[model samples]
Target: MELESYRYIAIDGPIGAGKTSLAKRLASLWDAQVVLEQPEENPFLADFYRNAGQHAFQTQVFFLLQRIRQLQAPLDPALLEGRFVADFMLEKDMLFAGLTLAGEELALYETLYLQLRPQARLPDLVIHLQAAPEILQARIAERGVAIEEGISLDYLQRLSECYSQFFYHYEGAPVLTVNTEHLDPAHNDADLRTLLQHIEEMRGKRAFLNQGG
Candidate 1:
């Protein structure tokens, strides 16, 4: 399928995978409306990173509510010929909850997720970014978001694995898995063009982008 043919595109990946940057760039390039996670707005995020046991529930709940609000609105028909691009897909929130929460907390989170998830719509296309944990860690450190200072390599490794597993079985939308280990679409215009070209050239429901064209 061609890139512009997709009216809604969602980008998914583990933290530090550069999904947000790519989402923003694609939205801008296509003149599309962008829906992002807005992680900075989550008050419990920093605390959760520092003290996951004490703060995981609050952080996850905050994201669930906030993201549902963002996802509930139907794509604006009034907007010009453009797409809606979001940095996250709703179900992956469960991935984090599963990783961090357990027992009653997890059960409660699942219950709430089931209730709120009906509002979210699947995107026509999903761009799933992939990168080694070491690369992700380096990018995270270079970007130097203070709240991310607490991110651990081990956590990133686990998150990357979870992302890989999640997308492997994902059937909600056509997914394009792009390995970013050798591509810097976030910062390099050439690399971004390479990705966009691959996106447009895609001919299957599932394709992988490894080396640039």
Candidate 2:
């Protein structure tokens, strides 16, 4: 599939794995619009990171609603106009909900998710970026976002596992999984060009790009 042939592209990964940066770079190269998740806009995120048990429901609900609105509004326009690259997949809401919510809270989240999920437009191609937990931790530390200061390696490991499981059975779109431990497409021109070539050459429902070892 050529890069231009994909109208909707979604790039997903665990936190600090650089999905957003790569999405932005790809969008620029393709002259595509970007639909990104703005964690900073979530008022409960910092608190949720500090005390997940206390603020988990609030944080999850806020993100769910925000994602739905973004998908319906800005993303809809871009999809109709031309190509767009998003940093998130709509199913990512459930991934986080499962990680944070429990018991009745989880049940309630599922109910809301079922109601809003059908409204989302599925992506034509999903780019699932992977990296070692240590690499993710280093990137997180280097970025130094205040809310992410409390992120633990254990949490990142679990998140990475969740992402892997989610994409393993993902059937809504063709998936291109790229190991990013040694690949830096966001800043390296050679890496970006190589990745674009790989995207152009993709001809299967599922593929792997393992430059990391």
TM-score of each: 0.92, 0.95
Query: What are the per-model C-alpha RMSD values against the true structure?
Result: 2.1, 1.5
Error at 133, model 1, angstroms = 0.9
Tens digits of per-residue lDDT for model 2, 1-213: 767789989999999878999989988888888988999999998988888899999999999888788778645544467788899988888998999889999999999999876555678899999898988999999998998888889889999999999999999999999888878899999888878888889987898887844
Note the residue pairs that clash in candidate 2.
Answer: none
lDDT (CA) for every model shown?
0.86, 0.87
Best by lDDT: 2
RMSD, model 2, all Cα superposed?
A: 1.5
Displacement of residue 170 (Cα, Å) in model 1 is 0.1
Structure candidate 1, residue pairs in collision: none
Regions more than 4 Å wrong, model 2: 75-79
lDDT of 1 by residue, 91-198 (tens): 898999999999999999999999877544578889999888998899899999999999998889999898888888888888889888888787899889988888
